[model samples]
Target chain A: MTVATFEASAPFHIPRWLAPFVVLSFAYIAVPFIGTNYLFEAILLPFLALSLAGVGLNILTGYAGQVSLGSAAFLAVGAFAAYNFNLRIEGLPLIGSIILSGFVAAAIGIVFGLPSLRLKGFYLAVSTLAAQFFVQWALTKFSWFSNDSASGVIDAPSLSIAGIAFNGAVGRYIFSLTIVSLLTFFAYRLVSSQTGRNFIAVRDNETAARIIGVPVLKTKLIAFAISSFIIGVAGVLWAFTYLRTVEPAGFNLDRSFQILFIIILGGLASIRGAFFGAALLVVSPLILSRLGSFLFGDLFNSGVLDMSQRIVLGALIILFLILEPDGLVSLWDRIRKRSVARLNKRKHVGRAAQPTQ
Target chain B: MSGFDWQFFVEVLIGGLLSGVMYSLVAIGFVLIYKTSGVLNFAQGAMLLFAALTFVSLVERGVPFALALIITFAVMVVIGIAIERVVLRPLTNRSPMTLFMATLGLSYILEGAAQLIWGTQVHGLDLGIDDVPFEVGGVLISQFDLFAAAIAAALVLFLSVFFRYTRVGLAFRAVADDQFAALAVGLRLPRIWATVWAVAGLVALVAGLLWGARLGVQFSLSLVVLKALPVLVLGGFDSIPGAIVGGLLIGATEKLAEVYIGEYFGGGTESWFAYVVALAFLLIRPSGIFGQKLVERV
Candidate 1:
C-alpha cells in the first residue's frame, strides 16, 4: 500500500511520496528481477523469520526486562501447532492455522511465565529452561505431534492464501515479508501503547511499577503472552516458509542463544535493532567462513576452518558486547546524527565543504 | 517393579549422591566466582572442557601424567587471570544479567578455542580407577564413583580450611559478604577477584580430570554445565555447601524419578528432571535452600 501521495509541485523532481514507492518497487520488483532464487531461499526468507523472532524476544527480554533462554521452545510449539491445525481441521485457511498456532504458543508461554512472579533474574532464567527442555522432550517423544512419523519431522503442507500458491521461493519470500511487516507493525503499536509503558515500568523496577498502580503480575504475563504470540508466528514462518521440513530438533538451545544474541548485538529496547541483528546473525557466519577459506585456503581443511569460524564468532560476540552494548543500531544512530549535523552546518555556511568521511 | 525394593533404592540413592558430588565440583567453580563477585559465570562448563582437553592432549603427546597435570593447571591459571583482566575487570560494575551474557559469550570463545587447539576427536581419559562395583549390604556401588566422592570431600575440606585460616580467604569472605564495605576497608578487589578466578580455574581442572575420565574428553564435556545450573539453583548461587546439598538432592530425586516413573514419560526424563525439580524448589524458596535471601529496594 502507498503511505504518501505525490505532490504536483515536485512533479519534475522525485517527491517525498515517491521515495517510499521507489524503495518498495526496488524491494518487490528489482530484487527478484536481479537476484536469484538462491538468494531468496538461502538468505532473505530466513532473515525475515529470524528478525521476527528477535522482535518477539526483544519484547520480553529487552522491553519487559525478563531474561529468557527458551524462545526456541515457543517457536517449536507454534510450528507444531500450525502443523496440527492444518492437519486436524479440514478446509482451514493457511492464515487461520498460523494465527491459531500463535495462540497455542502464547498459552504455553503463559504457563512458563507463571514462574516469573516468584522468581527473578537468573532464577527465572533457569525456570524458562525447564520449559525449553520439557517442550522439546514432549515434541520428540510423542510421535503423535509428528503425525506418527518415527523420525519426528513433519513436512509442512504447501501454502496457498485464497487462490495464490506460495510454493516457490519468491512466493514464500513475499508471504513471509507481508506477515513480518504486519506483525512488526502491531508490535510497534503494542510497545508504544499504555501496555508497553507498563512493561518498561516493571522492567525498570517491579516495586516502583506496583507503587504507581501498574499490575506487575499482569504486565509480565502479558509480555510473555505477546512475546510468545509473535515468536510463534515467526516459528510458523520458519517452518512453513523457510525450511522444507520442520522438526523439533531444528529449534534447540543453540537457536535460543542465536535469538538472544540477535537482541543483545542489535541493541536492546529498540524495534529496528532486531532487523540489524538478524541481518548480522544470519550473514556474519557466511562471511566469516568465506573469509577464512579465502585467507587460509590451503592451510586448513573444512573441520579446522569450521572451528576457526566459531572462534571468530565467539570473539565477535564478546567484542560487540564490550564495544557496543547498545548494538549495531546505536552505531548507526551515531553516524546518522553526525552526518545530519554536518549537513545542516554546511547549509548555514552557504559553502559545500566536503563532509568528513 | 512389582514390590518396593529397599536395596535398589539405597543403591540408586548412593549412586546419585556420588554423581551429585561431580556436579557440586562444577558448581563450586561457579560459586567461587559468584561468591566474590555477583556474576553468574556461565563459562564454567567451557573451562571444564578446556582443562580436560588440555590435560588429555598433553598426555597424548607423551608428556608424563604428573607433568601434564602441572601444565594443565598452569594453563588454567593463565586463562583465568586473562579472563579476569580482559572480560571480568571491564565488565565489573555491570548488572548481573549483562555479566551473565558476557560469560555466556566467554563460553563460546573458550569452547571454540579448546576444540581448535586440540583436534575434535574424542579421547578416552584413563584415570586408572577400576569401575567394578563392590557390594555393601547387598547394595552395589561403583568403585570409581566412590573414589570421585572422596576427592570431592577432600577438596571441600581443603577449601573450608583455606577460607577459615588464610588472610586471602578472609578477604574473599569479606568481599563476598559486602563488596562496597570490603572496598571501603581497602581490600584489593581486583587481586582478590583474580585469585578467586584462579582458584575457580583450579576447581575446573579437578572437575575436568574426573569428568573427562568418566565421560571421555569430548565436545559433550561442556554439557556438564547444564547439570551444574540446576545444582546452583537448588543450592543457591553463592553458597558452597548449598551446592553440595543441592547436588545431592537433585541427583537423588532425578535418579529415583527416572527409575520409578520414567516409563510413564517415555523414559529419558533425566534431561529435564533436574530442572523441573529446581523449578518446584524455586516456587517454595526463590533464593534456594541455603542461598542468601535477595532483598530488593527502590
Candidate 2:
C-alpha cells in the first residue's frame, strides 16, 4: 500500500460527499461575499436553526426509535431557561447561559423520557403531548419567565463572545454556524459509537437488546438527554439568533410538528437527512408562494397560499410514507446511482469502440 | 376552606361529567380506529372539524338541517373509504408509528380541505335547545348539556347493540382480536376497516356539531382531539367503555382542578389537567382501566 493511502471504517455508511472543508468554506467564506442580506437574515438563519433542531430530533426519534411530539416544548424550555440564566446571572456570558440552559432542558427531557421506559408507540407519542400543553400553559401562566413583561414575549440577550459582538445578519449567522457545527460534529460522533448501536438494538427489539446485555434504560435516557441538550441549544439559536425574540407561543405544537416533519421528510436515522429535510422545509414555502403568485395572479392570496401549503405538505408526507419511506436522501441516492451507472456504460462502450488506443 | 360545600362540589362534578360526555364523543372516534387497525388516528380532530364545518356551511346556505346532516354523513363516509383505499391500504403492515404519522398527514389534508371548501369564518350553531341553566334543589344545569348527555347515551347504546347483533360488527371484533387470524379465516379486512372508519367519521360529526354549538364552528374545534388523547391514555386505546369512563373522570377532575387549585397556578389549569391525571394513571396502570393487557413476546 502507498504511504499516502490510509483506511477507515465507521459503523455508519454515509452515502457521499459530506466533506467538512467544502461545506465550511461554502457556508463561512463563499456565502458571506456572494449572498445578500435577505438571504442571510430570512433564509439561512432560520434554516440553520431548524437544521440543528432536526439533528437533535433525529438523534432521539430517528436513532433511538422513541418518537416525541413534544419537541417544541423542549425548545421553549431551552429558550426560557437560557433567557433566565442570562437575565439572572450578573456577568455570565451569552454562550455560558446557552450551555447551562441546554443542561436544564436535558434534565427535563429525562423527566419526560421516564414515560418511554413504560410506554410504547402511540402511547408514548400521545403522552408527550402532556409536555407540549403543560409547558405552554406554565410559560403563559407564570409571568416570571418573561421577566414580568406582561406580553409574555422576552427579547433575546445581545450576542457577544469575548470582544466580538454579533451585530447583523451575517454576524449572527456566523455565530450560530459555529455553535451548530461544533454540536453537530459531536452528534455525528455519537451515532457511530457503541452507545448508538445499543440504541438501535433497543429500538429494534428491547427483549433481544436486554438479553444481549445492553443497559436498555440507560441507553434510552442517554438518548433523551443528548437529544434534548442539542434541541435546547438549537432553541437558543432560534430565539436569540434567528427570531431575536422568545415567547411560549413561538414554540407551540405546530413548531414541534414542523421539526418532526423535517426528520421524516429528511430521512430518519441518517444525519444528512436532517439537513435535506430542513432545506426542503425552508425552501418549499418560498417556492409555493412564488408558484402561487405566478400562476394565479393574485387570485390566490396569502390565505389561500397558506392553505395550499398545508395541503401540499400533508400530501407530500403521505406520498413519501407510501412511496419512499427512506425520504428525500434515498430519492437523491436513486438518481445518483442511475447517472453513475449510465456513465460507466458509456465509458465501457467508448473503450471498446477505440480498441484501447 | 369554608365548611366543605358539598352542594357546590356536586354541581361542578355533574357539570364536568356532562361535559365529559362531549369529550367521550370524540374519544370514541379514536377508540374505533385504534381497535380495528392499531392506528391511533390523529386525524380524528380534523375529521371532527371537517364534519362540523361542512354541516354548518350547508346549513348556512339554507339547506334543511336533516338534509345537511345526511349530506355531511355521506361526505364522511366517502372520506373514510378514501382514506382506507388511498393511505392505509398502501401503508398496511407498517409499524404503528408509521401509520399514526400517515394519519397526522391526513389530519393536515382534512383541515386544509375543510377550510378551502368552506371559507375560514366562524359560524355560531344553534342546536334549537335552550342553553340557559335551570335550577333544581339549589343546583343549576343547562338544558343543552342534558340534551347532549342523552344523545351520547343513545350513541353508546346503539353502538353496543350494533357490535353485539350485526354481522359486520362480528367481523370488526374478529379483526380487532387478531388481524392475521381474521384474514386466515377469510374475513374482509378492507371492508371492515372501511366500516370502522365510517363509524368513526360519524362519531366525529356528532362531536363536531355538539362542540360547534358550544364553542362555535372554527379551527379550534380540531383541538378537541387533544382532549381525547388523555381520555385514551386513561381508558385504553381499544375499549369504547373505557373512553366514556375516562372522559368522565378527566372531565370531572379537570373542572374540579380548575375551580379548586387554578388560582395557585395563576388560573387556566383546565387546558392540561386532564393530561396530568391521565399521565399519573399511566404510571400506575399502563394499559388503562379497561384496556387489554399487552403481553410482549420476544
Q: Write the per-residue lDDT of candidate 1 for residues A1-357, one digit (tens) a residue.
A: 111122132212235446445755687878877879878887888999999999999999999999999999999999999999999999999999999999999999999999998899988887898888899999999999999987689988999999999898988988998899889879888998999999999999898899999999999999999999999999999999999698898998889988999998898998778988999988887777778778878676777777776676667677887889899888986776466556556565664553332
Candidate 2 structure quality by residue, lDDT tens digits, B1-298? 6599988998999899999999999999999999999998999999999999999999999999999999999999999999999999999989888888899899999999999889788999998988999888999887899899999999989888998899988888899999999999999899989999999999999999999999999999999999999999899989999999999999999989899888898888887889889888988998888988982311
- lDDT (Cα, 0-100) at B98 in candidate 1: 86
Candidate 1 achieves a global lDDT of 0.89
The regions of model 1 sitting more than 4 angstroms off are A1-25, A350-357, B295-298
lDDT for each residue of candidate 1 in B49-81, tens digit (9 for 90 to 100):
999999999999999999999999999999988
Model 2 Cα shift for residue A319 (angstroms): 0.6
lDDT of 2 by residue, A118-138 (tens): 887777888888888888999
Q: Scoring model 1 with DockQ, what do you get?
A: 0.59
Docking quality band of candidate 2, CAPRI definitions: medium
Error of 1 at A115 (Å): 0.5
TM-score of 1: 0.95
Worst 10 residues of 2 chain A by lDDT: A1-10
